[model samples]
Every structure is written in structure tokens, then in C-alpha cells.
Target: MPAINQQSEPVIEIRELVTYYGERKILDGINLTVESGEIMVVMGGSGSGKSTLLRHLLSLNRPAAGNIRLFGQEVNKLSSRALHQMRQRIGVSFQGGALFNSLNVEENVAFPLREHTRLDDNTIRIMARMKLEVVNLAGFEKLMPSQLSGGMIKRAALARAIVMDPKLLFFDEPSAGLDPVVSADLDELILRLRDAMGVTIVVVTHELESAFRIADRITVLDKGKILITGTTQEVKESDNPRVQNLLNRRTEDIPVNADEYLQRLTDDLAGL
Candidate 1:
């Protein structure tokens, strides 16, 4: 399905993207678009290529075939200088906070400024505090990662991600390790960031509640292909078995041979 509003250039446009890890295809002929200022969620079960697709969006992983355009610029064709400029316009937060253990919260937030701008130490510190404040961690600048709760660490990481005032933000599994209440709060914070910053957000997750709550549109991936792309309402109304399985949270009931099941269990146990 097409997006709700299509008057302007899409913040992100990907077509026929095929990515592979060696010979195994991770993303196959995937197509997607994220409109400016909209919250787009990419969702899937484990090994469904959601993260691979996000890597393309982040310019970390290029497609083996097809193209990715970010804000009208072809990502694959970007020169190093262009790519660097493009990266400055985007912010990314990983599933883990990815904060620097060596630096305090304020210094972690100030890292981008120090690397990318000519700002003095005092100015950078002040700006870092302001960004921390935006994420509700104003007075916690002096705190270390070990001193903060999981949610606080996540928020502090967010403050750092947005310190450069990016136009696009990518989040990988924002609610992965969080409790239900914390996950919901993270969802609300996502919405607030969208409204407050007017930035395009691309979130990769399998968390159904968080996906539905924060998404303006969603793309569901299955077996290296997009099962569907539509609004939350459209997805709910879909009659496709794959989509139904996801929405209804039903596991496959296909009967496995006893030996196969035992071997699978053994494999899992052996891996552990």
C-alpha cells in the first residue's frame, strides 16, 4: 500500500534491495519508503532480515542489488565526504545503549560535537547538558552508565544520538530488554521525540505492541522478503496467513518428526 501522504520526497526510498551474508540471502528484493517526519517500523520474527534492512537504511550495509536513496541522495553512490555529511544528518541508537564506559553521561553526549564540530569544551558541555535535558536526564549528566537504570541509560544514549540535531533517527529494538511499563514509556518517548523534533524515525523491532503504538506505517518481513507494507489498521485487516500468524501470535503447528525435534533440542543445548 502507498503511504498516507505522498506530496513530498520520501525521507528514505529503497527498491529491489538484495543483501547477502556470503551465499545466504538476508534481504531479497525488499522495497520500502519512509516519508519525512513519519515514524516507520520494520518488523519481523527472528532471522527475518529486519536488522539487515535497517543496516541499508543506516548506510552500514549496502545492497548486493538495487538502490537506497536517503533524502533524495543515492546512498550507494555517495562519495566518502558526502557519506560523512549524510551520516551527520542521521542519528542511530542500538538495542544496547552503546554508551562509552570511559566517559560520563555528559562526555558521551558531547563526543559527537568533539568529533564533528569546532566547538570549545565549555560550549560542548553546555550543549550536551541541553540535549540530556531534552531526554529527561538533565541532572544526570555526571552519572555513569553503571549508576543509572536500564531505562535511564537508554534515555541517556538517546540524548547523545540526538545531540547533533539529526533529521533522521534509527532505533534498533528500543524495547528489547525493558519491562512492560518501561517498554510503554519508551514507546511514549519515541512519539514525543517525533513530535518534538519533527524527525523521521525508522525503528526495527518484533515487539508488536511497541511497533503498533509508535508506527505511522509498518513493513513486515518474512523469510527475507516483505510480507506486507501498510498502516497498522491495514495490517490488522490483512487475511494473509503469515500476517495472521504475527498478529495473533500463533506459532506454527507443523508436526516435526520426533528425531528432528530431539535433534533440534540437542543442537540448542549443545550451542548453550
Candidate 2:
């Protein structure tokens, strides 16, 4: 869909994106747009290409054919230095925290500032602490990753991501492995970050509850195609069967083709 709101330039835009792993196609002709200050939740089952799309959005992976624009700048055409400069404005909280074990929570949170800026140690420390407070990890800053619970680790990672006060934040699986209460708290935190900081947020998650709770709009991918992109209610009331199956958690029964299976087995046995 052309951005739901085009009154202003989109924060992120993808057009006719096509990607492949070796010869196997992954993302197929995807086109998406994320508006400023809106939370866009990308959801899909396994092998649905949600992660591939995220990689493209982050400029981690390039598409075989298409354009990716961030803040109205073409990502593929940017020079390395320009790309690095653009990346500094974006922050990512990866799945599993991805924190450095050698560092405590505060040090981990300060790493981005330490890398990107010439701020003094005291200023970096204060900035990191403020972000920790925002994520409700204030007193726990002294703790190491090994010493914190799953939720604490997530919050610490979040503090690190926002330490730079980025204009765009990418959160991968924010609710994964978190208990219901902790997950709900994290959802509220995401909402608060957008409202208070005016940052555009893109969350890649399979957690339906978290997606619906935090998303202004959602993009649902199914086998590399978008089933629908709309508000929570529009997705709920979607007439598409694929969308309905995903929403209702209905598993499809695949009827195997014996001829295709035999051919695949024959190819593997022949090492083709």
C-alpha cells in the first residue's frame, strides 16, 4: 500500500524488493512504507520473510532487485561513510539482547555513545543512566548480563539502543521469552518511547498480543507476500483466508505430491 499517510515523507520505504538466498527466493516483490512517529509491526510465521525484510530495512542485506530508502535517501546508492552516518541515527535492540558480557549494564548502554561521539565519560554515563531510567533499569545498571533476568537484559539492551536518542528504533522480538507481565510492561515502554521521544518505531515480532498492543498499523507477511497492511481492527476483520488462518492460528494441511517428493529425493541422492 502507498503509505497510509503521505502528507509527509516516510521514514522508511521499500519498493519492489526481491531477495534470494543463493537461488532460492526469499522476499518477493515487497513494497512497504513506515510513516514518521508511527509504530509498524511486521509479523509472520517462520519462513515468511519478515526477517529478510527487516534486514533490508536495516541495510544489513541488499535486495537482488528493488530500492530501499531511509529518510528519503536511497540506501543502496549511499557511500560507505554516508551509510555509516545514516546508521548512527537508527538504533536496534536485537533479539537475545546481544550485550557484551565483559561490560555491566551501564557500560553496555554507553558503548554506542562511546563509539559514535566525543562526549566525556561523565556525560556519557549520565546519558546512559537517563536512558536506563527510561527503560526502568536505573538501579540495575551496575549488574552484568549474567546477573540479570531475561526482562532486565531486554531493558538493558533497550537502554543501549536509545542511548543515542535515535530518530528511528528497530526492536526484534521484544516479547520473546518474557513472561506476560514483563512483556506487557515492555509493550507500554515501547508506546511511551514513541509518544515521549517522537521516534518512529519498527518492531519485528510474531507475538500477536504485543503487535496489536503497540502497533499503529501492521504489515502481515505470508510466504514472502503481504496479506494485508492495516490497522489492528482491519486485520481482525480481513476477508483474506490467509490472513484469517494466521489470525486464528489455523494450521494448513499440506497434501504432498508423490511425484515432486520422489524427484527431490532423486536429486538429493544424485547430489544435484
lDDT of each: 0.90, 0.91
TM-score of each predicted structure versus truth = 0.90, 0.95
Instruction: Please state every model's RMSD to the true fold in angstroms.
Output: 4.2, 2.5
Clashes of 2: 0
Best by lDDT: 2
Top-TM-score structure, candidate number: 2
Task: List, residue by residue over 42-113, the lDDT tens digit for candidate 2.
Answer: 999989999888888899997899999999999999999999999999999988999999999999999999
For model 2, what is the C-alpha lDDT against the true structure?
Answer: 0.91
Give the lowest summed-lDDT range of ten residues in model 2: 1-10
Give lDDT tens digits, candidate 1, residues 7-59: 88999999999999999999999888889889999999999999888888888
lDDT of residue 5 for candidate 2: 47
Residue ranges of candidate 1 with Cα displaced over 4 Å: 1-5, 253-272
What's the TM for model 1?
A: 0.90
